[model samples]
Target chain A: MAKNQSEVSGIFTAGSKSKPSAAKPKNPFTHPLLLGSIFPLLLVVVWEVLSRLEVFPAYQLPAPSVILGTIAGMAEDGTLWGHVFITSYRVLMGFLLGTAAAVVLGSLVGFYKHAEALFDPLIQAFRSIPSLAWVPLFILWMGIGEPSKIAMIAVGVFFPVYLNIVSGIGGVDRKLIEVGKMYGLNMFQLVRRIILPASLPSFLVGLRSGLGLGWMFVVAAELMGASQGLGYLLVVGQNTLAPETIIASIVLFAVIGKLSDWILKKLETRTLHWQDRAAKS
Target chain B: MSLQLERVGRTFAGKPAVQDVSFRAEPGEIIGLLGTSGCGKSTLLRAISGLDNAYDGVIEINGKKVNGIQKTTGFMFQEPRLLPWLNVLDNVTFGLEGNREEKQKKAGRYLESVGLAGNEILYPKQLSGGMAQRVAIARALATSPEILLLDEPFSALDAFTKMQLQDLLLEVWRSYRSTMVLVTHDVDEAAYLCDRIIVLRGQPGTVEREIAITESRPRERGSSELAAYKAEILASLDLTTETA
Candidate 1:
């Protein structure tokens, strides 16, 4: 089917259609994304302006200019890309593998009644234990190599996805099943047509949760003897009191996590266009 | 082409929902099951449709015991229950087991048949209550079922919408001529739709009255014919009468 788009014709075109934008004074300064930076920018401005005006020692709080120069130097040495790429690759691999495993198992258990009963207790048992708790054990099992870190990341992200898909499938309306059976659908047809489609909304939510968990786990995963990731750089920078790199890495992760979620949300909207239409109006 | 329900009964949680119910429907005829709320008319219909297993009965379609949900059967639930993730067309053809393109073909024909030609792309929640119910009906007919079961499928609708659907349903019945069983609390609905009406009443629900609708087809509300059938069903709920 074509991607979901708003239909030109509908039942009520005028009903609660517009978004609620505040009718406040159009202050360019109060935009929230910029507002977060405003105070920090003001502090830096005061510090720099005062220092240039011979107010306090410039050594204590290096000007934003000094930080920018350090960032440029790191960028030129290619350390920034290497660290960022390593973290990104690990996150991507862990997220993809976890998602694939979760989707297959979750949907299977959810769709098949016997499977749901058989696996639900086991999954519940596994879920009760936190992924972080596995970090020490995984390190011992696989050493401080990529396997240990990825294992931690995989464990961290699996449950949200698995539970979501299972519940999503389970949550599919009984009426839909009746409809299928009434039409003479066999077992396979029921799952392919009725169960999976109905469960998609819950499944999508699970995937989004998995993405967030992956981002969280990757940061923790890099804490053990990783030499090249953003997390490793942050730790090294902290020991040397290079606060700028620490701040940069944290900011980078925030941006990347936010960006990753944004991409998933976009995918969700595009793929589940029918649900979006159902929700609006 | 007929259906027979012989000594059919159901119990849930040790409570008798329906018991000792027997009936038959001829080919191309509509049979109505009418009762008060909690009288187990729906339970009986579910047993006949093979949806409920906590029952004892021999349900035969064309003289063959229906072991389970028959391939020739279609059911419209009280709720539309269309998949929220699928469009009207997808919902209508959801039960069609085939390649995607073939299902679409059959779905389009059924949608057009149900007076939903242009609204194929809409979702269930996007449709009006009447429209969603119409999608349910379309989904039912897309299977081209030989027997159709309906359980208060239009009761949620406003009066006008309900009447409109009744007429739409009559038109489809005339065209397809499938044997149908409808369970409804509305006595008028049973009178208007069915060639035979069975009324259930009691703690352990049983058929207390069964009236054959000898009136002509294309029945009207407030007509003496329909009024008599309505009164007959209502009178069955007196609880003093013996089982039919």
Candidate 2:
């Protein structure tokens, strides 16, 4: 009987006995940096092998080494740095302008029924038109200058940010709003403290997507106009029929996209640290 | 501060939820509004807290008619409802009126009082259900409001945790001496914690009965006197002693 009782007690205590240990820090080899590079490196190796075998026309599909050589030459003369700097500056400026406007307008629409009725339909209609379709009109109106390129990028960035902000604000728990009211928070305080923070994770998602679109729009804008950027390099390479230059520009675009996304992901993890803890415990 | 509600009635979609409910709670009194589900006890608490202003009649706090959300009232929902993004200390200090130092000091004291003295930096997600509710209680108390309104705050807890929280609540009440109106569905909980229990029954719930417990504080949980009060409340709700 004593043995049976011990067994029963042991069964009951099983869960408590296996206490959760603290999470061990990750090591370099197991880090996301190493893991994410594997596929890209494999693809590069395959491309270089195929190029050496002359699987495709060498002039059209230059070898990875040739692209690297072109990149080296551009770097030697400071052309690559200039292009990267100008493109990054334009994207940053346009993304900020677009996202700021969207946050303000989207918040107003989400918080008030009158604002939703007035603004939502118009925004929805405009958003359906392709972003590239605006390039010609913007170039005509603002001329083929920096203003036109920035405007195009801003237009591309706006829709996703606006939609996500509105939905995020709308999706905030009603119970939370009631808690805010119970504490005697005014309308503004309720939004600032409760609504905004609650919606921030969703807002960050919008920002990341908006940023990607900002890069795409800058390319389209630069394709049309006089500029020294990655997009201009693509146009110049095509005009000169230099496949290495085209391939080099494409590689640069991928690198910049990955770097910017990495920065945003870091910011997301920092801001939403509570979510990670919640998921773990 | 005192709370006075006269003929308080609320209607949604032309159907009355609470009709002609009247009660008055004096300063430092612990009153429990007892009922089954759909009995409008929760609705009445909401009206008293000034969250529902479309109700008929008047709710007066310290002789002043409350038209909107009252600053002197601290309300606790059934859920702890702590913002997940904030730490325990920040959650407790939320909505407080004072500057940073005063709010932090008050929040620290309240957290300590709730047996969470060393857990000020913990996030709500890291806490167990009972601990989260305690943090909610601390948040409400940190404001130092004259009246504390709680709606079924301990119903979701396990029996042991519920009992412990009940005692903690009584201890807090004894020290703070603030007017408290608790809405609950548990007979033993109401009887053990309340100085006066107001029972509600039927749809469009109105006050059916009022029983005042003159039993002294620190009374034994299983004492015959408390059991008698519980029996009476159960009977008023049409629940037999066997089921209770």
| Model 2 stretches astray by more than 4 angstroms | A1-22, A25-29, A276-281, B239-244
- Per-model RMSD to reference: 5.5, 4.6
Give the CA lDDT, 0 to 100, for residue A110 in model 2.
Answer: 92
Off by over 4 Å in 1: A1-69, A108-130, A276-281, B97-105, B239-244
Residue-by-residue lDDT tens digits, candidate 2, A126-231? 9989989988899899998889899899998899999999999999999999999988888999998999999999999999999999989988988997669999
| Model 2 global lDDT (CA atoms, 0 to 1) | 0.88
How many Å off is the CA of A266 in candidate 1? 1.0
Question: Could you tell me the interface RMSD of model 2?
Answer: 8.6
lDDT for model 1: 0.80
Give the Å shift of residue B238 in candidate 1.
2.7
Estimate, for each residue in B56-106, the C-alpha lDDT of model 1 and write its tens digit: 878889998876788778888998888787778888877777798998888
On the 0 to 100 scale, the lDDT of residue A207 in model 1 is: 82
Best by TM-score: 2
